[model samples]
Target: MNSNVIPFDFDGQPVHFSLDGWLNATKIAARLGKEPTAWLRKIETLEYISFMAEALGFNSVPGTELEEIKALGTSAPGVKKRILELSKSTGMVRSRAGSSGGTWLHPKLAIVFARWLNTRFSVWCDLKIDSILHGEMSTRVQLDRACKALEDRKSQASQDGKGLSSWRWDRSSLEQSVGYWLGQVQMTLDLDAA
Candidate 1:
């Protein structure tokens, strides 16, 4: 839908709602020196919930990691119990094993939890304009620029027949350039996102 912007997509959609979006809220609170409760209104919202799912990469955390979560029969019970509760509430759990160890939530949802954990903006990024200086406006502007840069690169590559190498998230429309990718990295970082 974005004409002059690079649409962040997964599997071809027009959005990239990473877990970091919400999880990073905690960081926002930390920076604001607030109780971190005001922004919690989204705890029950789609944005918050979606962010959680995105944070947990594969949905359910690995059973192996669960044990380490709190040493099995110990203080971890509460966290484990909550995990189970959420499991029953949703089918987003993604479990794997061996080389693919560790529980993962979607990047977006994870961002919410991150706020719960850190409440620090250092985890997210602050490119083009610092969030402290520009807040949402500057960040949004930067995202727009990034998206446009990406789209322009994609169009040029397609015309150049650069071989259509896979870009982020299999986004064929994305331009191939290390700097572009680097900016993406910086963005994710600035957001203190996952």
Candidate 2:
């Protein structure tokens, strides 16, 4: 496993990697030149309602929806109700109950949150997401290529009349090479192996 990558299993498919500590609100806010509190408040406002509508498959904000959303309170109870509604609709955002509790947004929603913060931050999030998505496939391809190369090297060595001890040495070398290649791949993909 690479120290730089944190693997999260999504839907029990190929492991997804998130850059270490990528979701800290403070860090995101700092990057966007906004206070975390302000950013969080913005998330709870119109932006959140917009996300809910889109998540619920509404192409456009439904009639009077914006008015209703605006009318919704921003007090704790109001926020809690909204979070519950959103959870029922998409299950993508939630509010925790407790002193340490705060609203939690899925990565996709976090990206939307970033977009709400600033256009530059939004673009950055998009690139990061794109990298994660494409990096998985690229890393797999590189690993496959490395494995094939190692196999070819071993076959060539055998064809050259390598002795048993030589074959064992080659195997050891192959293991080390493949290990190193995998480490590089993991680093490139920002992924930790499961």
Candidate 3:
């Protein structure tokens, strides 16, 4: 799980995306001050309502059926199974349990959830998730690459006897290296933010 996880932060809280690009819905829900199970149940309720409306016609649901649907909640019978079916069919939402467990969602549902939480948050979530899905490198990864490149440059230079002394005289080269790395970092950040 760790091998496939790509983690990022929003509003200072950590969120993760799988290598296949599934966003960790649980983390985002927590960041939004929502309970994952309750939210899922809400989603299930909406799905059930939509199905009923389509089947029975909107505003034509029988009173008893409407009441039963309204009563559907976290403890509703077969709700988990229905949710699982929904996940299997649509691939939009998923729930995992135990350690490393949380609801994971496709970017589409995640954006919807974010919108339900807050408009600004939804926009941020949309951009971030879209960036991840589009294969943009995370800022952390970009920074790491830049740092490693700089280290490699220094090490290669140090292999010669001059070492630090060489850098003192080769100030232009050093400056160029620093400028390149800084630009890389900036470009990565800008891309991720986009």
Candidate 4:
């Protein structure tokens, strides 16, 4: 009942709309009782509905040409016309001219529109974040930063050796955790002996 909350029906249970994002359980649950074709369409329609709702709200989504109005500027006029018709058939409407020259929701269906819009936005953000943090670039960058920090710690360790015991100086947590100081000492001592 709260203005901030959006609720949806899930397997005969009323569930609160999540701001916490991208859970697969709802999708799985929604498909449980339907025929495969019906279930597939239901999930695809939800994704399509979400993208359509998001595009109307000044969002730049990677939807099909029909769902993304910005895509219309490049396509032929006849094709744009048909895409608009397809949008309306799928329960969306388009606007023309000035600041409001984009698609819009049927006034009677605003709540459904908003729920889908927020879900789409969240999903887009999640994809971007996942791409950044899960790639080879991210792995290389993180390891490079750690190695630089480790070198600085080794320099500090050599300076600390002038004072007395290895434990006396301020040490990196990694040195404490994995006995890096002792490993470095062993390497240095072996080199000196050779």
Candidate 5:
């Protein structure tokens, strides 16, 4: 394995973890407190199922085909069903003949799965996913700064006789300023901005 890759145990299943992160069906099942196969069967979308299958290295389709399928989005029920059938027939979710096969999921999907299973797990996964998507900055510091900035703006608006309730900062502006700081850190470290 490359030095950049790390190993993670999702419950009892060993995962080839990357900076981008992945979750396996076994782990999701564990987290959801459901049987793995049963849980997978219950998942509504073929795209989710297929993504998990591909991430686990089970899907036989070419990478380009997979990418194209992903680009098509998950709204078409017919397409999703057809893809799901093909994936299943091709043994997409099953591991090799003799091993404990499992499905692997991207961090985003993992977060979604967690959300579906448990609110607390969802919150935890959201924080982890946020750190992965956004660079790791001290959230407390950024939050404090944002809060202070908002307060100052509110104070100024009040002094000008603008009703405090109506004097609100746009959510996007706040996000941009905080995101700007995050971008600066990323630029300094030469990290990709998510």
Candidate 6:
């Protein structure tokens, strides 16, 4: 319902997503009969945190600093602040409150959550998120682009004195032949019926 949230049809279910490809982890977790907090707890491990930090373009913290960061714990004020900092700096995870409010995860991390949820769902999540991030084209649009490219190539070939004979066709003749064949088939069917 929030203007910032976009509704996505995911396998017949509507899921909210942010404009920058942040997936609504809360909604997905609920749909999958799991708690977002539970999954969050699972991923909050040092290994996952370090991987996420690096994947999000953050430099690896030194050993002592990393230990200090780990000590902040899930419920600590520092942990909340750190989550906010990570959201602002790296767009890793975010939470908001409203009708559409939920814990949103970056596409990268969303796939991790999906993998944690279900394998098939994870593959679908990966592809859907990928298409969202990288502008998906309709099959018709792709076909049109391919046709245009072929047309350009054909034109070049004609100009180079290597024109393709098979590419030439009489559209009117083709249409007339198709129409006549259809009429003949219809008449035969009508006669058989009578």
- Summing lDDT over every window of 10 consecutive residues in candidate 6, give the lowest-scoring window: 185-194
Q: Model 4, 52: alpha-carbon shift in Å? A: 15
Better of 1 and 3 by lDDT: 3
lDDT of 1 at 154: 64
Query: Can you tell me which runs of candidate 2 are displaced by over 4 Å?
Result: 1-27, 30-69, 75-89, 94-107, 136-179, 182-194
TM-score of each: 0.26, 0.43, 0.50, 0.19, 0.37, 0.53
lDDT of 1: 0.38
lDDT of 3 by residue, 1-194 (tens): 55456566666766677656677777767777876556555645446434544554343224554456557744788855555444334445566776557877655566666666678877877776666566445654655565666677678677876666765666566556556655664464333221
Model 4 C-alpha RMSD vs. true structure (Å) is: 18.9
Worst 10 residues of 1 by lDDT: 1-10
Q: Which residue runs does candidate 5 get wrong by more than 4 Å?
A: 1-17, 47-101, 137-194
Clashes of 2: 0
lDDT of each: 0.38, 0.53, 0.59, 0.38, 0.52, 0.59
lDDT of 2 by residue, 1-194 (tens): 13333443222323222342233334345445665455444425445645654776643234364456556655635664553453434544444454323454455556766677777656766665666555566665666677887888777777767554477667777778778778876677554464
Error of 6 at 72 (Å): 12
lDDT of 5 by residue, 71-137 (tens): 7655645555555554555354433221333555556456666666677756755655555456554
TM-score of candidate 2 relative to the true fold? 0.43
For model 4, where is the 10-residue window of minimal lDDT? 185-194
Q: Mind giving the per-residue lDDT tens digits that candidate 6 earns over 104-186?
A: 88777788878888898888777666655564334324433444555565676577543445335433444454455434432
Candidate 2 vs candidate 4: the TM-score winner is 2
- TM-score order, best first, reads 6, 3, 2, 5, 1, 4
* Model 4 lDDT tens row, 1-194: 13212233333443232212222222323334322123212333334544755655633224564344544442445544444344445544433343322233333233333334355433433442243334234333444455566667667766766633553454556445334433342243221110
The top-ranked prediction according to TM-score is 6
